[model samples]
Target: MEQIFKWLLTVSGGVIAFLFGAWTPMLNILVALMVIDYLSGMAAASMNGELKSRVGLMGIARKVFIFAMVAVSHLVDLLLIENKIEVGYLAMSVVITAYCLNEVLSIVENAGKMGVYVPETLTKAIAVLRSKPQKEEEKPVAPSTLEVPAVVAPNPPIVTAEVKKEEKEEIK
Candidate 1:
């Protein structure tokens, strides 16, 4: 038992050392953003009365896919024979930026839903991060004017003089 415990401790220490040596501030920021986004989504769902444990679990599963996508991007860059370090950093930066923006926006939106009065500056920042510009409503579209063709009636048969005489004889 003692031997097993020592081995486990050694392995855990080795893993921790590796992580600390390879860790970047950007990676930490990305993780923070991911957590915040998840929590904000949960809060928004609760506020909307649509919270479901199974759905939230699925949301988390989808969120985890972002990291897998980033990993795939890094692999692609390596396959392209680019500088692996620069490519990885660039990919991580972009993914982290997008995730951080999404999380912050979600948090702000949830706060708004909860009736919290956010500052105008913050709102503007969120809008810029989301890349949604305010716009005025435009004129409505005119309805199409294509006319439907009318149905034609079948021609009536003409009454002949012979047929009228036959009818008179029958009546007599």
Candidate 2:
């Protein structure tokens, strides 16, 4: 049993090394944030009675995709170096930073939804990071000042109780 455990540990270590190069501090923090986000999302969903198997599966898939993208970014870094280009790990760093921020935002949102008190400053920071500046041409137009015509429908004929009673008597 000890032998099997050792083998499993060795394989897992090798896989992590190959994927992340050296298990840097930033990578570790990103992984932790991803896990926290997922768990918090599940807790929030459970609390809100909104848990669904399909949605959970999709969430897992999305987490996997995030790592896949990071790996791709690392590959891009390696490719640049291999081709004699002097680019460093900038691509990987940018990709990882973006994903980490995204995960942090998601975790905060989940925590907030679960009735946790998230700090206003952190929320504002996230909003600023995620927001994109809009051009003047892209800005939404204000409400129109023009007046609109109202459609008036004719009233329907009214039937009284006495008329109904007379009609019933005639039928009798």
Model 2 C-alpha RMSD to native? 19.1
Candidate 2 segments exceeding 4 Å error: 1-16, 125-172
Candidate 2 lDDT over 68-160, as tens digits, reads 898888888888999998778888889999998888889988988899999999879877877898676755656695567888668967899
Candidate 1: tens digits of C-alpha lDDT, residues 104-169: 788787777766799989888877777866697886665575566888768878899999999999
In terms of TM-score, the best-performing candidate is 2
* Model 1 pairs in collision: none
| Local distance difference test, candidate 1 | 0.72
C-alpha lDDT of residue 77 in model 2 = 83
The list of candidate 1 runs beyond 4 A from truth reads 1-21, 80-88, 121-172
lDDT of 1 at 106: 81
- The TM-score measured for candidate 1 stands at 0.53
Error of 1 at 23 (Å): 3.3
Supply the TM-score for candidate 2.
Answer: 0.65
Q: How much RMSD separates candidate 1 from the native structure? A: 15.5
